[model samples]
Target chain A: MSDDFERNLREHLHSEAEETREFPRRLRGRIRDGIAPRTRARMAPQLALAGALVLVAVAVLVVRNPHVIFTDVPSTIKSIFQQPTPSPTPQPFTCTDRSGGTTGASSQLSTIRTAPHDGYDRIVFEFSGQIPSYDLSRQDSATFVRDASGQPVTLDGSVGIKLVFRNTDAASGVQADAKPALISVKEIAQIGNFERVLSYGIGLASSQCVRVLELSGPARLVVDVATTASASTTAAPTPLPTQPAATDLGQFSCLDHSGGVDSGSAMQLTHVRVAHQAGFDRIVFEFAPQPGATAHLPAYTLSRQASAKFIKDPSGQPVTMRGSAGLRVVFHGASGATSYSESRDQTPNLPVVQEVAQLGDFEAVLSWGAGLSRASCLRTLELSNPTRLVIDVQTP
Target chain B: MLMDPTLGRVIERWRDGDRDAFEEVVDRYGLQLLRTARLILRDQALAEDAIQETFLKAWQRIGSLRDEDPGPWLTRIAMNESISTYRRRHRFQALTERFGRLGGGKVEVSTEARLDLAQALDRLTAEQRAAVALHYYQDLSVEDTARLLKVPVDTMKSRLKTALRRLRELTGSDEALA
Candidate 1:
C-alpha cells in the first residue's frame, strides 16, 4: 500500500512535467548570443593592440598639427584615445566631538529625541544652558553610573554604551527615567547625579559605530549610531563644518513629535491591525475624525512598562495582555465609541510583538497595551489621508 | 550509472570550445532541467528563465564539467537558480505588497491531476518542498539529495519524513484519494 501511495504521489507530482518537455527553439539561439559577448571579451588583447595603433596614429597627428587633428579625427576615436576620468575616492568616516571648550555655566538636559534615518538613527539631547563636556564610550552592556552617589545603574539591552556628561544636570526634577526610541537604540536613561556630573546610559540593540557632534544655538549634543557601516549611502551627504541641521532629517523623521499635552477634541478610533515586516513589527491604529472638525493626534507617550498588566484603564484597573515586555501607548485627543481589538498569532512566528490589546477609550483618551518578546527600540509615526498612527517595534 | 557515450563526447567537445557541441547538450538536457526547475519554482515562466540562465552558466563554466554523467550537476544548478529566483521575487512582491502596490493572486495550476498536489506543496516551506522534489520527483537518494541541498544526512531525512507525513495527511483528507 505504501509503494502504491508513493507511485500515486509521484504520478501527481510529475503530471505537469510533460508541458515543459520540449526545449524552446529560441533557447539555443539565446545561449549562443549570450556566449558571444564573453567569447569576444576573451579577444581583449587583440582589441587593445588595435586601439593602441589608433592612439599612436592620433598622437603622431596631434604632434604634427594639433588643431588639424581635432577636425580630422572622428569623435568616437577621440573618445577612445582620451584618458578616462578618475572617480573620486569616498572619504572615510571619522568621529569628531566638538564641545567648544565647555562654558562654565552648568548644562540642563531638557528633552531627548530620536529619529531613524536610512541606514542609521540619530539621538539628540537638547540642553537649556551651556553645552556639557561629555564622554561617549561603547560598553559590553548598558551599565550607567550615578553622578551623585557613585552607584551603578542598569539599562536595557545586552550590548550598549554610556554617555557621561560632566557639569550637567537633568531639567526635570526626576532622578532617572528611561526613554526607548529609534531602531538601533533601545533606551536612554539618566542615571542618578553625583558630584555635579550627570551620567546617562544609552541602551543599543547592538554594538555599532557611533559619531558624536556638539551643536550650538540651542546647545545640544547629537549622537548618531549607525545601523550599519554602509548606511550613510542611503541619505544624501550633509555638508560638514556646520552643525547637523533639522533639514537633514529623512522622510521617516516626519513621524517624530515632542511628547506634549494636548487640548484638541478626541477623534473616533476606527480599527487596529498588526503586520510583521522585514526588520520590525508594525501596529497601526486607524482613526476617523468628526465631520467639519480637523482631527488632531496629540503627542502621546510610548514607553515600556514593567509588566504587560501595568497598563490601566481610565477608571484605574489593571489591563492584561500576553508576552513578557509590555509597551503602553497613550494617545490624547483620541477615543473610540465602540472598541475593537485583535490578537495576532503570526505564522512562521515574528520575533517580537506577540499580542496587542485595547485597554480603554475612556474620557476621549485612547490607550493600548502591546505585548513584545522583549523591550526593544520603538518609534511612533502619524500618517494622514484617513489618519493613522503607526508604531514600529524593532526585533533583534 | 553509465553515461551515454555520445553525450560524453559532446561534453568533451564543448569543453574544447566547440560551441555547436554545447547545443547538443542543451537539446538533451533542457527539458529535464526545466522539469526540475518547475518542480521547485511552480511557475512556468520562472522555470524557463531559470533553465536559460543555467544553460548560459553551464556554457561559461564548461571547463568545470568533471562528471561523466552531467545530469545531476545540471539539475543541481537548475534547482539553485530556481530557488534564488523564487526568493528574489518573493522579497520584491512582499515589499510591493507592503506599500499597497500589488494584490495577492492564486497560483495557476496546469492540470486537474496536479491541483491537489500543487496546493499541498504550497503549504510546505521552501526547504521541505525542495526535499520532496529531489527525493520523490527526481528519484535521488536521501544522501545525494542532502549533498545537493548542502544539508546533513539526518536533517534531510527528517525533512523528507515531515514532508511525506504532511503529504499523506493532505491526501488522506480527500476520501477519494485515501
Candidate 2:
C-alpha cells in the first residue's frame, strides 16, 4: 500500500476513535436509565391474585405450607395406616415398659414432674394417655408437655426441654405404646426468676401436649384418662406450630440475638432461631420482652440495601416498628424484662443486642404465616454471641 | 401461572398508578439498579446518586415508554445524564479557551513521530476528530458513525477521507506507502 494511503487510513481511524467518545456518553446514559426502577406501580389486582394463586400452587405442590392445618393425614404416613394387618382387633393392654406391637394398649396421662434427674434437668411424665394395647410398630409420637409455669423451664440449662419416656414396668394391665411418639410443651404460669413469660403463646399438637407439663411449679396435671382411641382416628395427627411450608424463605444468619425473622409469605410469626449461612441480612424485632432485662434498644439502627421486618410475638402481641420508616421494630418491656427478634431479611447485629452476652452457640429457625402460604422458618443469625435469644417461630 | 411474564406485567401496572406498586418496583429492582449504577459510575457514592436519579427519571417519564424495551431505554437515560455532566466540564474548558487560557493539555499520544500526527489531529475540527475516534478506536462503520452523530452517511465518509489526506501530507509518508 502507498505510504500516503496508509497514513490517511491511520488518521481516519484516529478520528474514528475520537467520535467513539460520544458513544460512551450515550451508552453510559442508557446503562444509567436501565438501572432505574420503573415508575409504574399499578399491578392489576387480578395479576396479583393470579400471582398469589400461582405461588400458592407452587408452594402447595412443592411442599405443604407448614401453616395451613392439613385435615388429611400426611401422605408420608397415609400408606402405613391404609394397609392393616390381618387378625382380630387385639384388646388394649395397660402394661408399662412393654414393647408391644400394633395392639399395645394406650396409656392415659398420669402425673408430670421436672426434677434434676439422671444428672440432667428431667421433665418426666407418668403417661396414662390412651393408646393401643399391643405394639403399633408404625412410627408415632404421643407424649405432651409444657412450661405451664408461664416461665420456660430451662431444659437441663438448655434452651429447649428434652422429654425422656421411661417404660419402667408399671402395674399389670397398664400397657405401653411403641416406637414413634408425640411430645408437646405449653407454658402455663410464671415461675422462678425469668419474668417475660417464656412459653406464653406456644401451641403444641393436642396429642404431643402430654409429655412434660411444665407448670409454674404449682399448676395441676389433669391426665385426661380415656379409652384407647382408634388408630385410624388419630392417624392423621396435626403438627406443632413449628412446621413450615416448602417455599418459605428458609433461613438467615444474624449477628446477634436482636436479629429479625421474616418471610415474603407474610405469615403470623410463630417461632424464630438464629442460624449461620453464607452471608447476612437485617435483624428482626420480637414483640415479646427480653426474658430478664430492662428493654433498651441498641444505639444504632443498621442501614443497607436490604430490609428488615418486625414480626408478631408468638403470644400475638403487637411489636413497635421504629426507625426511619417503621423498619426498625422495638418491643418495650416492663423494667428489667427482655424480648427477642429473629434476624429475618438479614443477619442481625450480634454484639449490639444486650441479651447475647453469652455465646449461646446455637442456631434456630424462625417461622411465620401468610394468608396465601405459610412462611417457612429461616435461620437468620449466627450465634456469634452468647446468651442469644434463639426464638423458634412456628408457622401458623 | 408463570411469573416472568407476569412480573413484566406487574411492572407495567405499577407504572400505571397503584401507589404500592412503587414499592414493589423498588423491592424488585433496588439491588439490581444499584449494581448497574456502581458498574457505570465506579464511585460508590456517585453510583448511588446515579441509581437514585435513574429511578426518579423512570418514575417521572415511564409513561413515555410504550415499548417493552424498558431496560435499554432506562440505561440510555442514565448514560445521557452522566454524559451531560461531562459536557458541562467540556463547556467550561471551551469557556477557558475563549479567554486564551489553555486548560489541561491532552495526554501526548504514544509515538513522537505520531506527535506531529497528534498535533495535526488537534488542529482538525472536532467533528473530524470524532469521526477518526469512532472509526479507528471504536471500530464503528461509517454508516454507524453518521447515525450516532446524526450526520449523513456521505458526510461521515468525506470527513474520514479528508482526515486521512491531511495526516498523509503532514507526515510525508508517501515513501512509506510505496
Candidate 3:
C-alpha cells in the first residue's frame, strides 16, 4: 500500500532498536513455581537426555501423592446390592458401606473424571487400593464446609452431593473445578482433606437421583446421577411414592403384561382419561371404531421402564423426560393421529401420573410413556363396545 | 548468530538436568525475548507470561532442540508463545476484531503525537505485529524472519509491506519504518 520508508528514517529506526534492557525481575521464581511437582536431582552423572526427558504433564494426575496401607475405617460394612427392579421396601438415601483395610503399595485417590452418558452424567473417583469406607449423601445446598477448619467451599450448581472416603488421601491437583460444559453433573471438586479422610463435593443442575456403586480390581467409587429419573425421585429417595399400601395387590412382577385383540376397525384412539381410583390410579385409552357400537380393543403391552428414551425399535428417536421415573405403554394395531383431536402430550401432574407423553406412533404400533414421580406397579384391562384399554397404576 | 563457545556447554548441562545451567540460558536471552514479546502482544504482563511459558516449555522439551546457537531457537519459541497468547485472548473476547482491525477505518487516529509505538501495532493483526517486530525492530533478515515464523518468503514480505503501510498511517513515522 505504501512505498519503503526513506533511507534516513530506516537508519534512525535501526538505531532505536539498539536500546538495551535488563532481564525481567523474578522471572526465574515464576518459572520455578510452574514446575512445582517433584524435581529429581541428577540421580546419575551419566544419565542420558532420553531418560531425563520426562514431561510431568502426563503423570501429574497420578503421581502427585503417595500413601501406604489404609487403616482406621469402620470394620462392619453394609454394602447393599443395586436393585434390579423397583424395590417395594424403602432404602437409605445415604451410604454407610465400609471397605475393609488391606496392605498395598499405594492407597491414594489418584484420578477424578466426569462424563455425560446417554441418559445420565457419571462422575468417578478412582483409587489405587481397596476403596476406604465412604459416606455419600445429598446436601440441600451447593455450599459446603472444609473438613477441619469449617471454612465454606462454594460450588457452581444448585444441588450438591458430598462424598467422603475414610483412610484415603487424594493427589494435590486430582480434582480441579473444571466442570464439563453444560450438563446435569456440573462440578466435581475435592473440597477438603482433613486427617486421613478425603472429601469431594458434586454439583448438579437440579435435584437428581444419585446411584453409587463400588467396583473392584482397581477399586473405584463410581457415582451415576440420572439425567432423568431412573427409578426413584429426589424428594422420595426412600420408599418411592409409587409403593402400594397393604390393601393393594402385591407387586410380584416388573414385567410387561399384554392383552386385548388386534381385530376391529384399526382402533383409532379418540379420548384419554385419568383418575385416582380406590387402590390405584387409572389411565383410560378410549377408541372410536367405524362409528359402530360393537368393536374389539387393540392388543397392547405395559411395562416399567428405566427411562423415557427409546432409541431403538418403534420410537426411533430420543423421547423427552417428564417426571423422574417412567413407564412405557405400547399398543399394537392402533392409529395415533387418525382419531385423536387433542394434544398428544399431557402434563396432568396428577398424584400418580406426572405426565403422559406420546413417545412414538409408527407402523400400526402406538407407543406412549407415562412419567411418574417414582416407579410403580401397573395392571392393564381391555373393555369392549367401542373398545377401551384401561391401565391402572398401583399407588401409595 | 554464531554459537558462543560456553553456550554449547550450558545447553548440554541443561539437558543433563542442571537447573542453574538452564537459568543461565534465560539470563542470556530473556531481555531479547521480552522485547520481541512486548512488541508482538503490546501488553507488559502478557509478554512476561509468554517468556515464562517459553522457558517452561523449553525445559520440558529441551532434548529436542537440534542446533548449537540457542538464540534463534529461543526466539522462535518466544515468538510462537507470544502469537499464541495474542490469538487466544482475541478469540475469546473479540472475534470480530480480526476483520475490524484499525477500527475498520471508521474511528479516526488520535491527533496527538503518539508516545508508545506498541499501541499503534495493536491496530495490526497479531501476525503483522510479529512480522514488524522481527524484521524491523529485531533487525532480522526477511528470509530469516520467515524461517523463524515458518512462513513463505513472499508471505513474510507481504505482511511486512501491509503492516508498514498501516504503521505509517497510524504513527506518521513512515520515514523510519521502510
DockQ (Cα-based) for each candidate: 0.18, 0.06, 0.13
Over the stretch B21-115, how does candidate 1's per-residue lDDT look in tens digits? Answer: 67667766787778877877878777877888998888887777785677777877877888788778788654543455245443333334343
Among the numbered candidates, top lDDT falls to 3
Candidate 1 has a DockQ of: 0.18
Candidate 3 local lDDT, residue A215: 70
Which pairs of residues collide in candidate 1? A147-A193, A147-A194, A148-A193, A148-A194
Considering only chain B, report the TM-score of each candidate against the true chain B: 0.77, 0.46, 0.84
Worst 10 residues of 3 chain A by lDDT: A68-77
For candidate 1, what is the lDDT?
Answer: 0.66
Quote the TM-score that chain A achieves in each candidate. 0.37, 0.19, 0.37
Per-residue alpha-carbon lDDT of model 3 for B14-66, expressed as tens digits? 79887867776776677778877887787767888899999999889897788
Displacement of the residue B171 alpha carbon in candidate 2, Å: 22
Model 2 lDDT per residue over B60-98, tens place: 787886646354455445544443433453576445544
Steric overlap count per candidate: 4, 148, 3
Best by TM-score: 1
On a 0 to 100 scale, what is the lDDT of residue A34 in model 3? 52
Q: Which candidate ranks first by DockQ, i.e. highest?
A: 1
TM-score, per-candidate, Cα-based: 0.38, 0.26, 0.35
What is the DockQ (computed on Cα atoms) for candidate 2? 0.06
